[model samples]
Target: MSMKLITAIIKPFKLEDVREALAESGITGLTVTEVKGFGRQKGHTELYRGAEYVVDFLPKVKIEVVVAEDAVETSLEAIAKAARTGKIGDGKIFVTSVEQVIRIRTGESGESAV
Candidate 1:
């Protein structure tokens, strides 16, 4: 079966809930990273223009999970449910196809690599 990579950019605080949801959905492995960027909302500022605009870097967390195609929907739903705090900066999710996977230490392939 083919694989899918699900990447989610979420608020930092909701990470724990997302992790638990993933685990509950039978997703055992995922990679998380702290990232800084802006979206359609653009950047924000504070104070007078001359007095250090104080642009909020906007803290975010990135979660990456690879799963079989059949499991993709479940994983996506889990992430959505867990990451949804109904806040302005909750971030977004992206899903893409993966051709193959290989385990670094054991040389395993396919879903085992996940």
Candidate 2:
């Protein structure tokens, strides 16, 4: 069976919204990692103890979801909608084909393994 892996980098504040949206869209599981990076916006400056400096890495949430081929677009749409903030650092979504998936405990493969 064909599968797709979706990795979304979103603002940390939007994690809950994205999680709820994914669940409502029939996505049962996913992995999340707290990350930091910069894009076209580069980075930002803030005041720390009355001192101002530029922070190069912005905190973000990385969400990884693997699903059946048929669910790819719907899942992407859901994530985009829920994570959107109309801002420059809203982050990105990446999609690629997954060659295989295995659930060791159940020995299930393909979509079942997902």
Candidate 3:
């Protein structure tokens, strides 16, 4: 079976929802990172202690998952539904082909490694 890598960038507050959704979709494992970036929404201004500052990057959560090709659609739907807030900064999801996977300790490769 072919494998795929799914990457999603979403609002930090939506991480938990996305995780739960993925798990329910039969995706058991994923990697998450705290990230900062800007797109169409750009950044915003913050007023602190009488001084105003421009925030160029916004906090976001990056989620990465590897799954069999057959599971890709469900995974994408799960993430999109869970992360959507009907507003700007809801973020984006990307899917890419995976050439191979290897389990370091077990020496298992391909779909099994995933």
User: Which candidate has the top score in TM-score?
Assistant: 3
Q: How close is candidate 2 to the true structure, as a TM-score?
A: 0.96
Per-residue lDDT over 1-114 for candidate 3, one digit per residue giving the tens place of the 0 to 100 score? 899999999999999999999999999989999999999989999999999999999999999999999999999999999999999999999999999899999999998998
| TM-scores of all predicted structures | 0.89, 0.96, 0.98
Q: Residues 1-114, candidate 1, lDDT per residue (tens digit)?
A: 999999999989999999999999999999999998768646577779568575657778999999999999999899999999776777899999999999999999998888
Cα deviation of 62 in candidate 2 (Å)?
0.1
Q: Alpha-carbon error at 77 in model 2, in Å? A: 0.6
lDDT of 3 at 18: 99
**Superposition error at 2 for model 1 (Å):** 0.4
Off by over 4 Å in 3: none
Backbone clashes in each candidate structure, one number apiece? 0, 0, 0
Candidate 2 on 1-114: residue-level lDDT in tens? 699999999999999999999999999899999999999989999999999999999999999999898999999999999999998999999999999899999999888899
C-alpha positional error of residue 81 in candidate 1 after TM-score superposition, expressed in Å: 1.0
TM-score of 3: 0.98
